[model samples]
Target: MARVTKPLSQTEIKAAKPQDKEYTLRDGDGLYLRIKKNGTKLWLFDYYRPITKKRTNMGFGAFPEVSLADARRRREEARSLLARGIDPQEHLKEQHASALAEAANTFSAVAERWMALKKTKVTADHAFDIWRSLERDVLPLIGALPITAVKAQTVIAALQPVQSRGNLETLKRLIQRINEIMTYAVNSGLIDANPIAGVRQVFQQPKKKHMPSISPEQLPELMSVLTTASINLQTRRLIEWSLHTMARPGEAASARWAEIDYDAKLWRIPGDRMKAGREHIVPLTPQSLAILEFMQPISGHREFIFPGVKDPKVPMNSQTANMALKRMGFGGTLVAHGLRSLASTTLNEEGFDPDLIEAALAHIDKNEVRRAYNRATYLDRRRKMMEWWSEKITISS
Candidate 1:
C-alpha cells in the first residue's frame, strides 16, 4: 500500500521558512509549494504523462503572485486534463500558442497585412494617402481591438467625429476603405463576416457639389488672366497645358518627361498613374507643345514638368492651379478641374462627336465590348478634336 501524506495548511505553509537546502511542502493531489534556498516560494504540480507514464512537474507560478488557492485550482484543472488522457504540460503549451496567435490577428495586425497587399495594387502616392487617412481617423479608435470584435456600430462611432466636422466626403471614403479592409479580413479567414458591410447606410449621403467652373462665355477672361497673371511661369504653363489637353490637374502636374513623346506628339500616361486604371494618350497640340517648350528651360532638368516650387523632387500639388485661380479673382467661379467641364460643355456645343470627346477625356466606357472597340477606333478623331479645341481656346483668349 502507498503511504499518504497530509495536505499542507495555509498557516503552516506561510510559517515554513527557507532552509539551507531547497524543499517542497506538498498539498495533496500533486500540488506542492517549493521553498528555494534563496527564499523564493513557487507553486508546482507533480503529475504523470498520460502517454509515456513518465513523472513531470509543471509550474503554476510563484506563491504570492499566484496564491495557494489559485495554485490548487490550477492543479485541479491539470488533473482533469490528465483524466481525459491529455498531457497537462502539452495542453498548457497549446493554450499559450493559441493566445499568441489571437494576439497576432488583432485588428491593427490584420490591417497592416491587408495594407501590404493593397500597396501593390495602387500608386505609391495613393497608397500613402490611404494609410494617412487610416492612421489619422480609423486606427486610434479601434485598431487595437480584435478584428472579430469590430462591429458596424463601432466603426460608426469611429467615423462620427469626421462626420461631425462636416467632412462627409472624407467620412464616406473612410467607410469604403474600412469595408475593403474588413472584407479582406473575411477573405483572409481572420473573420467570418465584414463588420462594415451596409454600414454606409448609417450615415447621411454626402452632398453633391460639382467643381465650380466658368461657362464657355467666361473662358476668354479666365484665359486672359492666366496668360497675363504674375503667377510662377511653371504654374502658368501648367494651366495652359491643362486647358489645351483637358487633362485632370493632377495628371498634368505629375507629368514626367519620359511620358512625353515629342516625336509621337503624345503624352502617354501609364495605366497605373491614370484614374481609370488604363493607359491614356493625350494628343499634343501646337499650343500644348509650346507650353512644354517654355517649361524646358525652367523645369526640363527635372523629371516632373511641374515640380513643387519648394521641393523639385516631388510633383507639384494639384491644388496649385486652383489656388492661383482663387488669387486671380476667380475663387468660386473657376477651379483646375473645371477645365474638363469647360471642354466637355464647349466641345459638345460645337457638335464634336461625343465618342471623340469622351476619348479625349479618357473616360472609361461602361460597356466592355464597346470600350474595346472604341479604344481602337477613336484615336484619330480625338487627335483632330484636341487640336481644334486648343485653337478655339486660343482664339477665345
Candidate 2:
C-alpha cells in the first residue's frame, strides 16, 4: 500500500516550529528540511546508493538561505544521477577533490615545482636569476591561470611585449623556460598536452650581438690611458686585473681575497661566479699577482679583493671599469668585456693553442667539433699562457 506524500508549502515550512529534539519536514522526492534543537535549519537529500543499494544523506545547503524551490531543483538533479547509476554523494566528493587539485595546479605553482628540480642542475645564482627573470617577465601576465588552461595563444600574448622591446634574446630564453615548465607539467600529470610547445615561432629570432671592443693592437693606448686615468686606484687595478686574467668584468668585480693562493699563484673563481657555472682556475702571472699585492693594503681586511668605494662589505660596482674607460676618453672604443676579445685576438695570432686561449677566457667552446676538449681546465699549461698575456699588456708600447 503506497501512501501519497503531499509537497510541503512555503507557508507550512515557514510556520514549522523548532522542537526540543531535532526533527524533519518532508517535501517528498527524498528532499526535507531538518530543524535542530539549536534552531538551525538545514536542507538534506536522502538517496539509495546506485551500487550497494544503501541509503546516505547529502547536504544541499541551509534554509532560509536555500528557498523551497531550490531544494526541489537539487533533488531532481540528484535523482537524475541515480538514474545514470551514479551515486550523487560520491560524485560531489570527486568534484570537490578535482577542484582542489585544479586550484593547486596554477601556472605559478607548477613553475615553482619545475624550478625545484632545476635548481639542482644549475648554480644557486643561476637558479635565482632564472626565477627573478620569470617574476619580472613571465609571471605577471599568466601566473594566475591554471596550467591546464595555458594555451599557445596565452603564452604568445605574454611574450609579445618583451619582443616589442627588441628583447629577442630574453624572448628566446623565456620561450624555452616556459616550454620547460609546460613539459614539467605534462610529466607531473598536471595537463595532457603542452599548449606552450611551439609558441616561440610567433616571435622574431634573435641575432647574435657582440660586445663592443677595440683591436689588440690598441692595447698600449688603453693601458697608458688607464694608468693615467683620474679614477680611484682600485678602479684602475680592477680594469687591469680583468685584462691580465682574461676574466669577465663581473668576475673581477666580485673577486675575493680568500680565492687567491699566493704560493700556487692561482685565482680559483667558484662555480657560482663563473659564467659557464664551473670552477675556473686562473693561473696568476707576475702582473696579476703584482696587482693583488698592490690592493692587499687597501682591501686587506675586506672580503672582496676589489670592494666597493661606497661600501667595502659588498663587491665593487661591475660597471666601475666601464665608466672609468668611458670617462678616460675611450668611450665607444672599448668596454670592460672587450679585454677578453683583445686577449683572444692577440693570443690566437701569437700561435697559442686555441683551446688554451679559450680556457684562459673560461669560454665553453660550443662548436660541436671542439666539445671533446671541454673536460680539462688546463691549469698547468694555462700558467705560461697567462704570464705571456700579462707581459704583452705591460710591454705593449
Candidate 3:
C-alpha cells in the first residue's frame, strides 16, 4: 500500500522557512513547493510522460506570485491531461508557441505590414494621411491586441473621440481605412473576418457642405485681387494657373517644370500626382503659358514651378495660395478651390457644351467605357474651350 501525503495548508506553506540547502515540501500527488536557500519559493508539478515514461518537472510560478490555491488548480489540470494520456509539458510548449504567434499577429503589426503594401498602391500623401489617422485614433487604444480579439464594438469605442469632436467626415474616412486594413488581414490569413464591416451604420451620417466659393458676380473682384494683390509672385501665378486650368489647388501648387510641353501647349500631370489616379492633360491657355513663362525667370532653377520660398527642393505649401487669398480680405467670400466652382458656374451660364466643360475641368467619367471614349474625343474641344475660358477671364478682369 502506498502512503498518501496530506495536502499543504495555506498557513503551513506561508510559515515554511528556507534552510541551508534547497528542499521541497510535497503537497499531494506530484504538486510541491521547492524552497531555495535564498528564501525564494517556486511552485512546480512533477509529472511523467505517458509515451516515453520519463520524469519531468514543470514550474507553475514563484510563490506569492502564484498562490497555493492557484498552484493546486494548475496541478489538477496537469493531472487531468496525464489521465487522458497527454504530456503536460508538451501541451504547455504548444500553448507557448501559439501565444507567441498570436503576439506577432497583433493589430499594430498587421496594420504596419498592410501599410507597406498600400504605399505601392496609393500616393505618398494619401498613405501618410491613412497612417496618421490610425496612429492618432485607432492604434493607441487596441493596436497591441491580437487581430482576432478586436471586435466591432472595440473599434467603435476607439473612434468615439473623433466622433465627439464633430469630425464625422474624418471619422467616416478613418473607419473606411480600418476596414481596408482588416480586409487585408483577412485575405492574408491573419484574421478570420473583418471586424469593421458595417461600422458605417454605427455613426450618424455627416451633412455634406458644398465647398465654399464666390458667386459669379464676385469673379471680377477675384480676378482683380489675383492681378494686383501684394503677394509673392509665385503664389499669384499658382492661383492664376489653377483658375485658368480649373485644376485643384494642390495640383497647381505642386506643379513641376518637367510636366510642361512648350510645343504641345499641354501641361501633362502624371497619374501618381493626380487625385483621380489617372494622367490629366491641361491644355495651357495663352494666359496659362504666359504665367509659366513669367515664373521661369524666378523659379526656373528649381524643379517645382512653385517652389517653397524657404526651400527650393520642395514644392510650395498648398495652403500658401489660400492664405494669400484670406490675407487679401476674401477669407470666407472665396477660396482656392472655389475657382473650379466659379469656372463651372460661369461656363454653364455662358452656354458652353456641358461635356466640353466637364472635359476641360478634367472631371473623370464614372463609367469606364465612356471615360475611355471621352478622353479621345474631347481633347480638341477641351483646348478650344480652355482658350475661350482664359479669354473670358482676361476680358472680365
Task: Give the whole-model CA lDDT for all candidates, comma-separated.
Answer: 0.88, 0.87, 0.88
Q: What local lDDT does model 2 show for residue 41?
A: 84
Model 3 misplaced stretches (Cα beyond 4 Å)? 2-28, 31-73, 81-87
- Residue 257, model 3: Cα distance from true site in angstroms: 1.9
Displacement of residue 126 (Cα, Å) in model 3 is 2.5
lDDT of 2 by residue, 1-397 (tens): 9877788898988887889889998988899999988778899999899999988889999888998899899899999999999999889899998888889999999999999998877655457778989999999999989887899999998988999899888899999999999999999898898887878877899988787788887888888887777999999999989999888888888899999988898898888777777788888999898899999999988899999998899888878999998999978878899888999999999999998887788777788555555545467778888888889998973
lDDT of 1 by residue, 137-247 (tens): 999998998887899889989999999999999999899889998999899887888867998898987989999998988888888887789898888888888999898
TM-score of each prediction:
0.88, 0.87, 0.80
> Cα lDDT for residue 348, model 1?
97
Against the true structure, whose lDDT is highest? 1
Off by over 4 Å in 2: 1-4, 230-232, 309-311, 317-333, 364-377
1-397 in candidate 3: lDDT tens per residue? 9999988988988898989999989998899999999999999999889999989899999989999999999999999999999988889999998899889989899899999998877655567768988998889998999888888998998988999999999998988888988899899987778877998898978898887788778888888877788998888888888889998877888899999999999999887777777889989989999998899998888899999999989888878988999998888877888889999998899898898888777688788898889889888888888898899889878
- Candidate 3 lDDT (Cα, 0 to 1): 0.88
Order the numbered candidates by lDDT, best leading.
1, 3, 2
